[model samples]
Target: MRTRGSTAPHLWRPYTQMKTAMPPLEVVRTHGARLVLADGRELVDGIASWWTAVHGYNHPHIARAVAAQVETMPHVMFGGLTHAPAERLARRLADLLPGDLDHVFFTDSGSVAVEVALKMAAQLWLNRGETGRSRVLAFRGGYHGDTMGAMSVCDPEDGMHRRFGGYLPSQVFCDLPRTRADIAALDAALDRHRRELAAVIVEPLVQGAGGMRMHPPEVLATIARLARRHGLPLILDEIFTGFGRTGTMFACAQADVVPDILCLSKALTGGTMALAATIATAEVFDGFWSDDPGAALMHGPTFMANPLACAAANASLDLFAGEPRLDQARAIAACLADGLEPLRALPGIADVRTLGAIGAVQFEAPPDLTVLKARFLERGVWVRPFGDIVYLTPALTIDRGDLDHLLDAVASVLREGVPPGA
Candidate 1:
């Protein structure tokens, strides 16, 4: 979707093929689930800022909390200073999660959160004098983040980092769990390579950003058990599925599985500001509690616990506790499941799947991403498609009417076949 526009100041976009990417939309304002363009047009956000703003943009509750915290103190170096918001958020998260997952390490984003998880896992093994455990085991059809360490574990066939394959560390990939046979294979692989593996990373039930793939809860439970049995750290990258994006408060909770390390971000701040946390279990933390300074987990982001982000996160969590966010998510999921059901009969579409607030339509053949997206924009919806998948993950606050509009836009585009000149 190319567009001619008045030029603005310089900026670069991530994951964009700049040579052919569409002109960036200049969003001037946002409220609820809508984006207000510079031209005064409104486009309902179909993916919730890539699934971050679960409560929607410019949410009054989150905005007020962030404002209050900014006035108090925007940020302080977390190394020496302790703040209430961050502490509250950590404790709140620990209380929300199950098991011995009681420690929280703050970071600036999801990618860094994954990095911290990997680092913690490696350091934990090293602190125990087990230095051979450096490799991470991740499943195929998984994506944690874009950072080099995170990318190293993503599905190599996803082609997100094909060019950088040689530079990234080689990691083990287990087949995505589907059948009982697949579980047998996964167990065999883990058992065979137990000594070389340091951590087992997974995206839990839903693998966002890797074509928004999803699997059964049993798969995650199996991975968690296998990791524990192998004495390997299990890291659930819930950056996309945490905060009620996957029908549960955390996707792993649906399986009643507890991981040793959990990476959380995206919706942690209700999409207000960038903040992430790599939470750990007592065992992982205790591994670094020795008197040896070098055995410690030494990673920390400068804005580890930015007060504004923490305040927004607190308000978001408060909303989840006091409001009906989970109910809203379930409603959104039902809406998507019913709304996109018709698309399965479409000629180009091969399958349609819905989970929580996320709905994906996979094409039998790859659709022209740029042209399809242009048509969606023309229909006043902000739906982004990549490769052979077109997905909608609207804010939990989006009404049935707005969500229908978003779904209908995708259906209309599929019906019209991208138009004559789109």
Candidate 2:
């Protein structure tokens, strides 16, 4: 059992060096965009718990829906059993998404969703007996997840998975679209590797975890066109950019293109619980529809479509359906653009960019994220920095005052440099 101010040595933390790290903060409660610490301090959550909790924490509607579901049923085997929550959420998502991208398959989290997407794309060829098409194509600055398949395609120089280079599958990578929105190099690369390509996958508008990189809409449009021209499947990983994070419900809509497969998670359940979904077009689903059992897309997570998660997701989507979600997202984007504009001129800052509710400030040199995050925590806010970037993915429900507070905190930290004695 955990007690106040106790740090469990047994727990292993991800992306942490551990040896020199401080004990993790103890959070006792969360409501709206604020986190209540055991020490009685309240900190505004700037990253929204890794960009989830879009509707804010402990939303009444979502909490009630989930509680009601827990009373009836929490989970059941998804292989043969059917339930109301799963069916309802699936339908809601089908309607919410654009085009024939309607068929939804539930998973436990975003990384698993990416795994499912990779499998779905790979099986598209295997189902058709085209065994030669085994490789996948990805753009530079793209990041999918921590799963092995997802890691194989992340930016190679990104220090996280570079050490495991020999163990991962070799995927063809293309350069970021350069001047004149030209992807002639991309086209040539795809053509050169056409015979072995199974699909072309990317994070549509904004690349999360991989430095919050932004790409032009025209570049995204051209990617879809090239994928279609190459006769390969296109999978857009919108796990981080979905649910109005990129100023749209889905980033693909910005380019007016529909992908063969779409991965969603993080904010799917309003940050109430861990859940993810992989939605595909009918055309992609049809490829695996066969009499041969081996032709099926072979993947299923044990807790797939838990009722509580589905209920939370259903309520979360309901809020989006009835509320002025796009307006809120636009307001956030506008605020971020206006507020962050001044940072680019600051010393040691490389650039700043804002998309929808997302804002990023990249430093010319690496700053200790742990130290910087602690600095933000001291100012009663939570903002995690990685690599050369410190960014915010605040809840869309955050008011202008709180939003300004977060920006002010970032600016203050940059100006003050590291704390006096830390």
Candidate 3:
């Protein structure tokens, strides 16, 4: 086993080892949308710590709820016993989720949630005597998670799955249908692989980890229609797009479509605790409902439905009621869109896309603004540059001052140059 000290230097870094890379930023403390660095400087959290901290840092409501739950019952085995937190959370989620996606299966993270959804979809077909349908369909440039099942569905061309090529299962990759021709290509691909395909999974409206790629809701509606036409199960990985990230509580809701199975996490616990849920419709759940133990879904993590995570999720859900989070998200989206308008005229800029609280500015590699990443960091903002794409995915609770600071930092970076040796 690789000890912490033995592999820490190589494995614990982000970006790269040279230029635009160093040890991870040492955060001494955080509150709201600001991070207190070990050097006593505060930096606005531009990426929301990989788009997870929805309510930002140290949210009182979430903190209180977690503390209260921990004081009552810290941990318990969820196999044979039940808890109020878990039951209530499940009920709350059922109420929020569209249609009959009421059955909830808990997992430790978004990757596990994707794994659970894929397993359930595949086994559902197996239980129905359609064992030949084992292949999965996913879009090119789509990122589900780092797990094996997720890697199978993700685009291996992205370089994350290169080392795991031997372990990943064969999955059909379809072109992201940006235009009519692209959509036709997808239809053709599906027609060619329909016999072996079990399910078609997508990130829906916005592909976050896939360089914040934005797609119209109509495309998703088309995908849903195609899935239904082919009798293939559709799994929507809303782990990053859920909880109003795409201007809707769920991305599928925006398109007036629901999937056979839905994966959610990241913001489910208000970014307080790690929790993921795979929701399925009654018909899909029926496949696993059997008297024979072997027919049941034979998968679950040890801390599947930890009560503390459930409590945090419950509290996070309550924030949506009466707080106008969706409205706030819309306002922030508009603000970010307006803020990024200037970058469109900048040289070497390719595209500027905005959806809800997310905005991305793509630039050509190795240009004048190529060093904008280091500049933004020097200006006290932690904006991440995926290849040449610079994006802002701030917490919904970000104040106007912090938002302005982030925008100004980006503007300065585009205008000036990065600090010396940054």
lDDT of 3 by residue, 165-283 (tens): 77889888887777889888888888899878889999999888877888899989989988898888899999999998888899899899989999999999988878999999998
Candidates in order have lDDT scores of 0.87, 0.88, 0.85
TM-score of each: 0.96, 0.96, 0.93
The best candidate by lDDT is: 2
How would you encode candidate 2's per-residue C-alpha lDDT over 251-353 as one tens digit per residue?
A: 9899998999999999999999989999999999999889999998778788999989999999999999888877999999999998888888888888999
Which wins on TM-score, candidate 2 or candidate 3? 2
Scored by lDDT, model 2 comes in at 0.88
For model 1, state the Cα shift of residue 248 in Å: 0.8
lDDT of 3: 0.85
Model 1 TM-score, all chains together? 0.96
Off by over 4 Å in 1: 1-6, 418-422
What's model 1's overall lDDT?
0.87
Screening candidate 3 with a backbone cut-off below 3 angstroms (N, C-alpha, C), the clashing residue pairs are none
- Would you list the clashing residue pairs of candidate 2? none
Which runs in model 2 stand beyond 4 Å of their true positions?
1-6, 180-182, 418-422
